[model samples]
Target: MKVFTQFTDEEVRKAQVSVLELLLINHPLDCPVCDRGGECPLQDQALAFGPGASRYEEAKRTYRKPLPLSPLVNLDRERCVLCARCTRFCDQISGDRFIELFDRGGAEQVGISAGQDFRSPFSGNTVQICPVGALTATTYRFAARPFDVATGDTICPHCGDNLDVNDAWACDKGRFAFSFVDQPTRLTTPLLRDHGLEPASFDETLAAVATWCRGGRAAVLAGGRLSNEDAYALSKLARTGLRTNDIDARPFPCDPSALPAERAQATGGMAVTYRDVELAKLIVVVGLDAEQEVPILHLRIRKAARQGARIVVIHPRRTRSYDVAEHV
Candidate 1:
């Protein structure tokens, strides 16, 4: 037969009911103080598709409970809606399997394995995916109100290419990491070591550099640490201003040809938008440690999977994506 498949409205409604059932039984019904509160799938899905009232006695299920297994993770049982997204996270996406549910029925709650602690590098994401404040970060516990923080959308300079830091708060590492530029350890004045060493003022530095390039051959071997403005300026000077293409800030050892073209940049470049992931029926990430490389994407992927998208992870080495993903 010809390949064909489609979910009927009734089938879709049933799937929605299944999701709602999970929320009714599992979610703590608490949204305040959670980082994922605004970004919460449970909150959005339940409000739209779940029962407005509880079927079971609310007191029967755990709520506002706490598990102190990892300093990075704080498990509040009362808030857990028992979605299993967190435990699935550690197992399918991360391959850590550090966290899981204990007991059965109403007694069930999220936790690290008995006498153990969740300790994966990406373990912190569990706190972000938790439907309620049930799971929280020790580092971000009770931090500023979400509304008080201003967000900036910029790709992380570190790690692999494409990541949209959705609601990157002023308190986020993206902002805090800028401290190095203002730190005393930073090389504010250009220094040239005897084996290429010496400190010089801005003007002196320019003159010295000009003298080197007077021979008609010089290159700016910059790093990804530079801001987009700085990289663009240097590139302009080398390419347009100087009629040379030697100014470069290649981040990794990959091929130079792989860089996005200027046209692509105008159309938002080789960047993978959140819309791409959302619309995808099945996404296969091959040979990449997405957890270590793009942590936030994993969170969004979790959200997408919850919404019925299939995620496949095929990595040579162990990875966190191995845990939460559907087709691991």
Candidate 2:
């Protein structure tokens, strides 16, 4: 078939519609409870281009969306615009087609075929792209609002060895993973093994910590997941304030003498934005399993495939994403 490289007058006419919005009139207005409320593209679009009033009736279509899509994400069909962004993501990016759209017409909606729990590792991205609150992250649900929360933009404190900060990244796990911090069995207060682990006064706790520091063999072990500033403060406290030679924070082995290789290679890596991935003529993965790790990336790669990118997979599970690619 001959390709239409440029928009023609007839094609433009066909694309026009009397509808004032890109979504169905039956969609819900649950932006408040939705995880994507602050950053949703659909909400933004509605403000600028939606009709003066909804054309839908209460009886036309109804469904309460959204249950968990996976451990990291949830799906609420009630708020779905049926954009299929989530479905395409699992099928094309995560290389796991655990979820799909079901039924047809106003009955049209998204869901897992067998009512099974979603188990994809990269399922978190589905919550990130859902134009509506249809998909949400389990870790972030009701944890805090984007506005109520404060973020300290700092560098990746890669194992807390006084690393340099070039670019700042948003905290997904820190903000969302509350189960670890708020577990019912968690020790919320300092437990004096002798004092019944009561909620001790701040001064009393400081004194105990100071006593622990008085000994010369005191060592510190830091995790890479710490923010750079927090790591630096810990390192400084151990080496300077405590005068201990046993200062350590890294939990895993590293070649820390050198810059973090993954970030260092970012400039040369396949650093394609969602839009760029959607527009690429060919998308090639270099040992990257987006579906297993980067669901948003996988979704955009799928979008590119839908738009005609020749998708090539250099990996195994990638055979799935590649199927969505033109030349798989």
Candidate 3:
């Protein structure tokens, strides 16, 4: 079939410019102080596609700035472009309909129902996906500019792409609970027991540890949060260097036979993937609060329920999945 895609077309270019102009009609001119200043998609697009100066001569619409939606998120109604990214994320992806577009015409804005807070475990995602500075993280508000901050590429320990877990999404805790690293009380240097936990250099600490390990038996008990590579390194050090097999990565003991079939599949390396959950006809969740514990899994279960799967959640108390699953 013959088709005409309108890229570089004069009419299409004019239409794009007009859309940018309309989007910026009520957008605040506070980009200097805005958290998303250098990294804002709206700002970049406006500079690229919008006219040199705005034709909006009338007084711009305004609202009370920086409304706290929850303890984690702040909303600026005037900066909102009404693209519905946050609202749609709540309603469609997270299944947490805490916020929605309110009112009509120019007065319309994103807001929560009376007495409701945007307390969803996935609420931070809205801020991450916002095109403008309308939604800003409370912990990260004005923390640093894009130019001031240095970034490093690292695989997230919480969720990763290999498993298709939390694909393009993360729970609030994984997304926003990083402020503790800057605390004054946080240990930046290793400590030695020369007197009473005196600060020591890494060389001194490692030498002391090596001496102690050589003099006596040593076993490695690594945290469960260690990455696969770290765990492997630790395992190698314990088995090869220390000549010991008394190394374990699990924080606690778990009986494989007691685990649910799906969990057992995972623990036993049998590969019960998220696709299995989506295609499941009947899913029985046993003693797992998937929403608070494993949110992405909860989302997958919800998606399955939407696609005609029956979900039964068996727990001591009700959970957030009660809306989509039968609570037992």
Candidate 4:
């Protein structure tokens, strides 16, 4: 029952070399321009364990360059080593069978069905887990090499510290929809409507806003991006300072009384969690499309269904969870 993993033995070293060679038999040599060039696992393994030179001189297999699997993901068939990480992620984790290993033998590659697109909310994860540059994110296509980029640790704005919630996964919006921060049209300062829209100093803008508030009624309209403390302060300001009941934080109009009970259930010590969903006997969803709204929750609901939980979704239309849940 002895297991050897280190390449100390000559046979083990030779076996490792052979495996690397076979994996690189048809792997393209376009690492110089690849998005995963500097951080690729295959590149590091090839440099460490692969033979110094290749013996094959025949023409390499090719595919149409940079096939758009979706608006967020692109595929280069020739660069794929058939590791099946992307396919497995889709099948096992996201439950979105958008792409699969098509064809057979040497011609086998990852692809989607004709006229189909990778439309999953978790599709960006495949690019993150790819061993090679076969799968690349469209937003990051040739944007920067790994060595050229600087990264810093920051709290995820979507979900805070609940490990049982998303389980180390982020939806595509949280993962890739960050380009707007750097867009040219993004507002950096307050704009005053003096002669159309002109950038004004914070003091000037606040003074004008205060004058307007003093003149007439001001109803607080807070955006969803506000924190709990900010929301509380705004609520106080709207209730006491402005003496108005017309305050809403939601982007859409809804009855003020419609959500307080629901919010109390979530915040008043009785919260429905992912673990609860996984162990529940029955889950009744009302007016909520989990897959389109909260993808990680959708995955948890699917897991619960696989574990023999009955899921009943009451929505206006059928959702992606229809396969695993009963539609009402």
Best by lDDT: 4
TM-scores for candidates 1 onward, in order = 0.50, 0.51, 0.74, 0.82
TM-score of candidate 1 against the unseen true structure: 0.50
Cα misplacement distance, residue 59 of candidate 4 (Å): 1.6
- lDDT, each prediction: 0.63, 0.62, 0.80, 0.81
Model 2 ranges with Cα > 4 A deviation: 1-15, 18-59, 64-74, 104-107, 136-175, 178-189, 195-199, 202-215, 225-244, 251-328
lDDT of 3 by residue, 147-195 (tens): 7898665444453322332355777766765556678998999998866
List, residue by residue over 95-198, the lDDT tens digit for candidate 2: 56788888898688888867677776556556666777787777678777766777664532222221222231112332244356567887666755454546
Residues 289-310, model 1: lDDT tens digits: 5555455566556556766778
Clashing pairs in 3: none
Sequence-dependent TM-score of model 2: 0.51
> lDDT tens string, model 4, 118-203?
99889988988898989999988988889999876554454332233233567786677656578898888999997799999999
Question: For each candidate, C-alpha RMSD in Å?
Answer: 10.0, 9.1, 4.9, 3.7
Off by over 4 Å in 4: 6-8, 158-167, 186-216, 250-273
Q: Compute the lDDT of residue 306 as modeled in candidate 1.
A: 60
- The residue ranges of model 1 lying beyond 4 angstroms of the native Cα positions read 1-72, 76-83, 92-95, 104-108, 114-117, 150-163, 167-189, 194-200, 222-233, 239-328
Ranking 1 against 2 by lDDT, winner:
1
Maximum-TM-score candidate: 4
lDDT of 1 at 212: 72
